[model samples]
Target: MKKLLAECLGTFTLVFAGTGAIVINAATHGSITHVGIALVFGLVVLAMIHTFGDVSGAHLNPAVTLAFAAARRLPWREAPGYVVAQVAGAFAASLLLHFLFPQDTTLGATLPLGSDAQSFVLELVLSAILMLTILSVSTGAKEKGITAAITIGGVIALEALFAGPISGASMNPARSLAPAFISGHLSHLWLYLTAPILGALLAVPLCLCVRDSTCCCASPTSGKS
Candidate 1:
């Protein structure tokens, strides 16, 4: 219960602050550029991780939660509830942002449908990288190095640089879904969900394939003496 609530609020913060920056930037002539938008998204994730990380692991994206499940870091039973909470919180934040900034049509939303396939493919690939990096940095094996925060933020900034102009670089399903509904634009919703989820799912196997078996706990063998 507390964990779910934390996940909800954390996700809401990510979309609200990050996309809200988009709305504000678009409304102003030169106040904030693409770089600024990317910064907002990255910084929001950084702050939120430090905020709700200890409680809920700050998984603001369904894709992320699913990835953790796939990696066996999170129990499968808890995923559905976490995803629901995250989506609800995101949509609520979107509604608030819409109410606050009615003049900004973009509202820091994801890219529209019919965008070039070249860009879409890039978004998908980069999104996968983002998920993979998140899993790697946040896992118990690596979190001990105090690199989780920095690594996740760095990956976000790097992916944003790659995908910001193309498909809005959204590796987060909840972040994309809320604004789409609030703005009444369902364009490319599939890409936003499919690409990120697929990317995140792919990370599970990819991480396992590269993980050092020696670092993991050894199993007891009955026949061994």
Candidate 2:
């Protein structure tokens, strides 16, 4: 229960602050700029990880939760609850944004600036890199502490900086889903939903190859011989 609440609150804050930057930038005629928006996403994620890291691992991203489960760091049973909390939180944030900015369209929903195929490949690679970084920095299923927060936050910021103009640097299904659903920008939504998951899953094999087998793969026995 506490974990779910933490996930919800953390995700809500993520969407509210991150997408709010986009909405405000558009409303104010680019006062925030692309760089500023990227920084906001990164900083907010850093803050959330610090705030809720101890409680719920501060997933705030369904791709991340699923990746952790695939990596055997997190139990599969908890993935659904985390995903639900994240999506609910994201929707809550988007709904609030809609209320505040009634005339605003898209509400910072991620859209492909290029062809769907281009954005799809970009999202996949970006998510894989992000997931690999998370796996390296995280402890078991939990992404808490200063190291995890800074490294993970840095990776997100970096990716968004480079990829925001292309694929909106979504990297998270819940983050993309809420605004798209609310703002009626559903076209090309399938790529955002599928690519990131596939990318994160792809990272599992890569991690297993580079990391210790015990760290990346689940073991059935307690003893090591």
Candidate 3:
């Protein structure tokens, strides 16, 4: 129960702070700027990982949680609860944003600025890189400690800096889903739903290549997963 609550709270904070930057920026005519928004996302993730990481492994993103399970870091039985908590927290944040920004349509939802395929491919790569950094720096399923914080945050910042204009640099399903559902921008939702998970799963095999066999497999103390 504590783990579930940690996930929920971590996800809520992430969605709220990150997307809230977009909403405020749009409302204020980009005062936050693209760079500022990217930094907000990176910093928020860092803070959350440090805050709730030990409790829930800070799997605020469903793709991360699912990928951990796929890589055998997290148990399959617990994946559903993690995903549910993440989605629920996202919904809560989006609803609140909708209430606050009734005039805006996207509610900071991730929309493809280019063709669906283009955005789909971009999101896939972004998620892959992000998850790869995560798995490499993390211990087991836990994204605790300084190295995990800096690397994960740095990746998010870099991805958002380069890809936000083209693909929204989502790399996060729950983050993309809440605003889309709340704001009724579901036309390209399938890409977000599929790409991040696929990319994250793809990182599992890649991890095995760059890391020792023990690092990517399942074992309590063998650094597998």
Candidate 4:
């Protein structure tokens, strides 16, 4: 139950803040550029990691959690609970955004069906890099020995700046899911889901290799191994 709650709250923090950035991005009327949105989004992840990473690894994204599950970093039984919590948290955030900003049409969600294929592929690649960085910094090799909050936040910030324009840089399935629920668009939902998962999947082995390198004193198992 504690783990489930942790997942729920962590996901809530992610969607609430991430989607909030989208709201800011659109409503700011050019005040908040892509860089600004990415920064805010990254900060949100950084903050939540400190608050919830210890309890549930702060896996606010279904894709990230799923990757961990596939790698056996997390139990399979917990996957559904985590995904459910993530989706529900995202949905609740969306509802609140709807209430607070009822007049706004966009929910700060992601869709790539109509977007250029090249752009979509670029987004996927960027997302992979971000996920791999998160795995490395948070887990092993380049653990950096920094606080989880700072490291994850920095990762998110970089990802946002580079990938926000392409595919909305939605490396998170839950982040994309919430907006789709409210905005009534599922056209490219699969792209967001599949691409991010693939990115995460690729990161698993690469992170393993990097973490195994003898640059650090700690063993690979110490981090995400």
C-alpha TM-score for every candidate: 0.89, 0.96, 0.96, 0.85
Q: Mind giving the per-residue lDDT tens digits that candidate 2 earns over 65-169?
A: 999888888878788999999999999999999999988999999999999999999999999999998988887777646888989889999999999999999
What alpha-carbon RMSD in Å does predicted model 1 have with respect to the real structure? Answer: 5.1
> Over the stretch 160-215, how does candidate 3's per-residue lDDT look in tens digits?
99999999999999999999998999999999999999999999999999998877
82-117 per-residue lDDT for model 1 (tens digits): 899999999989899989988777666688434657
Report the lDDT of model 4 for residue 14: 79
Global lDDT of model 3: 0.90
Order the candidates by lDDT, highest first — what do you get? 2, 3, 1, 4
Candidate 1 — which residues are off by over 4 angstroms? 112-116, 140-145, 213-225
Q: Where does candidate 4 stray beyond 4 Å?
A: 113-116, 139-146, 213-225
Candidate 2's TM-score: 0.96
Judge candidate 4 at residue 11 and give its lDDT. Answer: 77
Ranking by TM-score: 3, 2, 1, 4
Residue lDDT tens for model 4, 51-150:
7776667788887777666555566666788889888888888889888888777688775534657555765686678777666655421223447568
Of models 2 and 3, which has the larger lDDT?
A: 2
Could you tell which candidate, 2 or 4, scores higher by lDDT? 2
For the record, the alpha-carbon RMSD of candidate 4 to the native fold, in angstroms, is 3.9
